[model samples]
Target chain A: MAATRALGPAPSKTPDKPTDAAGQAPRRRPRAWRWADIAEFAGSAASALLLTWLIFDRFLPFRIQGVAFFVAWYALTLPIYWLVVRDGHGPVAARDRLASVLVTTGAAVALSPIFLVVGYVTYRGWSVIDFGFLAETMELTGPLSGADDGGLLHSLIGTLEQLGIATLIAVPLGVLTAVYLSEISGPLARPTRLVADAMTALPSIVAGLFVYSIVVIRTGWGFSGFAGSLALTILMLPTVTIAAEQVLRVVPGSLREAALALGSPYWRSVLLVVLPTARAGLATAVILGMARVVGETAPVLLTVGGTNILNVNPFSDYQDNIPLFVFNQIRSSKESFVDRAWGGALLLLALVLVLFVLARLAGGAGPGRRSRRKKGAAK
Target chain B: MTTQESEAPVTGQPVGGTLRGVGVSAWFGARKVLEGVDIDMRAGVVTALIGPSGCGKSTFLRILNRMHELVPIATLGGSVLLDGDDIYGTALPITEVRRRIGMVFQKPNPFPAMTIGDNVMAGLRLTGRKTANREQLIEESLRRAGLWNEVRNRLGAPAGGLSGGQQQRLCIARSLAVRPDVLLMDEPCSALDPTSTRRIEETILELKDQLTIVIVTHNMQQAQRVSEHCAFFLAAEDEPGRVVEQGETEHIFGSPEDPRTADYVNGRFG
Candidate 1:
């Protein structure tokens, strides 16, 4: 066996091992520091410092002024850090957050101009918003000597009358047309929908011209509140129809099935279930339609000629709306007339605000009553 | 079975109110959905209709109550009889037929805007039943549906606020409030979880005493569990659906005469 031993035979003795590693763990290389993180921190700190300096101190002469400016500036900066810097650490970097913040802040700043304009209006208009200013009519046409001689009671009444008639004409017709479009299915429905879409884009001035041509030029009728209402109806119909249709379509199909399964007729289902479900949205639609045509000056100017005195009758003769009254006041050479115009503008704004509040209250009351009734029945 | 037979004669008329179909076919414009089908529904028992999707099980269910009449293009052949009376006869009113035969859909479709109590009272009010005892009827209906205790204090709250099971129970309560002779349920438990499905099955078993029930379901176990009579509808080669076999639930599940029925019941195929 000794003579026949192989050249590469295995060693019988155990190999020597290192003696320095008695129950100790191996060492690891230190991790490389991330420069990007440090760069981001420095960048944020620098931006914050710059914003603080620009806002707190007068570092830039053209910088925004006062607490309003500081509030707005901080409001703009907080979102930038929250949205942009926090998400900017990924592998594929993008400026989406930054762009969003910039767009939103830019829009806020752009719309801020309206606040100043309204502030100026309120400051000037408050002096003329007294009870006497609302109680009397703006029939007087004298110079700037009489301070308590004029008010906008008549013009306010005329505006209400015209808008009310317009709503009466437009809302039912508009809502019915929308219902027909949504529920009735046939070849005729397509053309009807197309006509509604086309009508939606019809210009307010064109609507005025349409009414003027038909009622005034062709029928030999004089400019009156009725004609003005017809013109306003033309402006309001498409708005109501489109909005009501959208609200009606949003009503769940399940509600319809629930009604139909009860063996109720189609009209009964629509009247009871469908209408009640969409009542809140329908009210909103009506308010929006009223708001749209309430401020029309061209139609009123073309159809209902402006008057110095108020005319309550909508049929016989010309009547003055708030817009027409304001136009007449502004065109007059007298300073009192100009002051009355400002007052009338303020009054119109107040009327619209009141209408919006009432609409909101009406909408809120329905759901409240419904929930209360449900609770009563539950018990 | 003896109790059902005895009770059927005491409720207004005798002979256990029968609904029969004879060589009935239906078409949706050019498409032939159901072809030459015949079935008989007996009062006071649960009849299960099992089929795959688009096999016209729902169409057959709808035909019983004349719900298909609402569709402009849907056409029908032959006749459906209720108590040996032709339902499609010119003398009978569709509204009256629907009022007598109430339907519950697959989804738990309680009117979201209405309160639980109002939903239960909907069908009653629609039929001009404005009696002074409406409150009692509403309470009784909800209690019978096993939903009164949970929704007793919130009758005025919107039905939509209830959980899925509660809403399904509420829908059942609504159906029962009308006192219909027959209840047509189209996959009522298909949208429900197992626990909800169990509760609805218990409700169905309880309701079988007062009304005839026809249920359309895809779950074989559910059909076996809840139904007394079972009808298996299978898709044909050229046509869509026809009844393959029907009998007592025990025979259908345990020892069906037809090989196809055995295969389906044993889970070899649907």
Candidate 2:
């Protein structure tokens, strides 16, 4: 059987290959378009639209329009499209086109909510945000005051300081814990990993309560930015640790082995070679951790008693952040307060967006991203 | 190719150290990979270990530099000696053992994040050893690895930008910068094109005078072309790898004591 198989015609010699139909040269590129495809799409869309309109307006007893009309049209479009494409092309092409459409639709559906939230916030808050709004504070403003009278300057400062303190405390500890988990396989690694995994799932409110009990109630530190920072730290630690560990784990074992073979002690290899190799990934991890805790309202609300005045000292005094400001202002039954709350929400969204952009920039062309050298054909 | 025009002789004195393995056995967890292997790799000559896949050639090469121990469950028996001192003994630190006996893997592995110059100088920085002139040392190492002129102007370029062959040579220069007494290569040319493989073979020949070179290769012609001495390793089905024969390259290829060695050299069953 082996000899017969080996003696038989080679696979390349076979004449029935789809790519070489009628002995013609194979077309390397996939034909993405045809005149019939456009016709099929147009026909499917028009027929679906007409059918939905007739069903809503004429065929059905009740009249439906607006979003429901479009939703009905969309629902009817898929099968119509499949039928049209199947007739025009084949079952394979029809299936491929349907899959592409479904995937694209799913992506659009997933992204729509984010767009709606951002658009709504921008529309409501665009008129309120200005140079003065950013520069001024709400120290003198009251619930009766106009929306234009007070700004989120105090809240912004509190957010920045609290995040700053939280980052300082959490990032180092988290990164060190990550190093222990990923690089060193000591006895505590399993238990430490378990704790960090559990902490990642810990509710934001629980983190706030833990800090509230330990730092605010027990230590009598009172409701301050420091306490808020501690709560944020508790929330941010597991995030940074897990992410940093993931980043560290990807620093190729070959690189570490190369370092060791070069006579580097293990710690030195990890410190100089392994850490530097994973710098961009580590930065991204930190940014992810920051994003995780940036919009946390419960922790800020529970630890830092909301205040109106701009307080830069995170160590003392009640301070308010953007989320807390939004939470408190939105609950009030005042138009101006609601507008201010929308403005705060917009600011928080903008901050998170900025952080994501920064993460992209930091992670994009990391230290030896492909050759940037324009000259010399060494190859 | 352009770099070879300026045939600047490598500056460093030949400091090759004789290496000897006595009854070296290895196990990965409970599975025995190699058993009672003995070989002598003389200084200032290229010694090639030719074997089939899974015959423990690479494993033995890694054992020379103490890289074998990096695997968590890997265990070793017997001793490897460099210049008549037990490398596995506590007399020398593990880092020191690795430094003296360098390694080049099958695939080129320069630190992707580092610049070309930095990659060459990585050994110095990693080992925390200082030099009088950093620029001079970098140039010297690159020159010895036969990669100087091609990369001379772009020393600051990221190492990741280099071609596969250039990267391999850069790894060689990185290893050479540490000035190791013995260099162990585990099929260093297997990942390269024919031109790159030839270039690496030429490099191995050139570097032979400056360091004791021990290479593991499945390619018989490569072993014949580069090595002065050769050891043929073999393993039967479900058996641990062991040295079948050892002699000069000429004798091994011409008239081997073991028929298996003859078969392997003549392109029979690996």
Candidate 3:
């Protein structure tokens, strides 16, 4: 009763101060793009560029240009922009705007390399790339042959075969290890997790050397695509395991308790309820693992003996993949060889993109998302 | 005991099973929470365990269905009996005991990945129980939980899309689909609004004849409204929780044997 007495009545919808006859306060309209903001930005940027040009051409003894000029202009733009914003929106808003500008600049700087690499690869390789180039192989083409004479078909096949084998070997083992760590958590969990974490930092070249020494030399497997896949699997496992463990750990404990309360055994609860709920995240983990090993050139170079001729069978003779192809061809003095290497690099980028899209499509809708397939209906 | 006092039979199916917690005590690691709590939750009736926060009410509720042992350090010191059989004994497997005695938690936890119909039938698949008529069982369970009409059209929709109250009811339906003889609800309606709470109360009243229910609640009015037998739990400073009083709801509320019970029921002190 004392608690209820201290509470008091609910507040009125409108404030007690001034209001219109309808008991409504004045509305503050939301504007996504204000003309004043745009003007201030344009004015500050133009003045900064002008100041940078004057400093380089007239004020300074040296005429530094190119990237340095733009860098200087960017350096000057911040303070100018801050001052202009301050004139319009006061100091506090100007500070907030400056912080957002810095964040955007940081993001742009971080993203520049991806854009530059993809753009340069496309520009250099687009001339030699066509359906014929994709369909044909380097088996018939000589060192003096033109860029159009050979294609990446052999290397493409080798890369796909090796990646598929590696994924098949690694994903199950990694996911199971993750499940054991998160759900079962026995005495070995600590040591297992420690080993997995340590292996994540293991150099790709070391993985290649280990697999080469064991499979290629010890077992006399030679340098086959299978040897290359074994190397890739060693690199891929820890990545998948660590990422998958993190994902599985975040699944709400309530779901586990709910499953247990329903008379579901421990293993059944993990298999049916926990794993299915974390499906999307596990797919992402697998993709991250694949991405880490796909462009690994040193490992494939050491494990997979580079071959010009197409070799579809991974367990037999030497095979060629995209990274190895790019590495070998780029070293040649011929313009055609260099062009083909760029084309291979571009194709590799496109392949990774395609794999991401395919994995996303196959992983299906995440938990709580509308699947629209009607396949989840009860029996 | 309340179990012997209520022996009237008015149902078609094999109705509520008597659940008794005999001298139940619980500990998390070394710290004891509940000590020697014995209560007779009579068949075909709802027994409400009311107590202040941190009084081990929820722990006792979890103990009934063996969910208390899920915690790594949680330890139990007594036996829970369902239908005259010791649930803690070697006679029945842990999974079988849980299947016969189901539970609903305070927060609604419908599987987000599952559809409404699938969530209801999840228990059967989880426990590996095969039913000949799955659709009929789902419908019957939903009807019993009073959530059939609201979700019948969207059975294929994700269970997570439902409102909080509806999700709680769906959890209830999921628990009911296994056809458990006893249902333990741990403050099932504490997170819901007044109307949803009232609807769940009505569902509880309707379900009393089919299976035994033991609910732990903090609200005295809810305890009085939903349960026939009431047990008040209390824990003094530096002591483990124990039952202060246990009797019919009317007698416990109107004329209790303990002054603490009266003070608690009257909102004077907890």
Off by over 4 Å in 1: A1-98, A109-126, A145-149, A213-221, A354-368, A371-379, B1-16, B69-73, B236-239
TM-score of chain A of 3: 0.86
Per-model CA lDDT versus the true structure: 0.77, 0.88, 0.88
lDDT of 1 by residue, A65-137 (tens): 5776666555555554554455775423335434544676688789888887667667666777788887787
Q: RMSD, model 1, all Cα superposed?
A: 13.5
Question: Interface RMSD of every candidate?
Answer: 2.0, 2.4, 1.4
- lDDT computed for candidate 1: 0.77
Better of 1 and 2 by TM-score: 2
At residue B42, give the lDDT of candidate 3: 84
Cα-based lDDT at residue A91, candidate 3: 100
Give DockQ: model 3.
0.57
lDDT of 1 at A262: 75
Chain B, TM-score, each prediction? 0.91, 0.96, 0.95
Worst 10 residues of 2 chain B by lDDT: B2-11
Pull out the clashing pairs in model 1: A374-B156, A374-B157, A375-B156, A378-B155, A378-B156
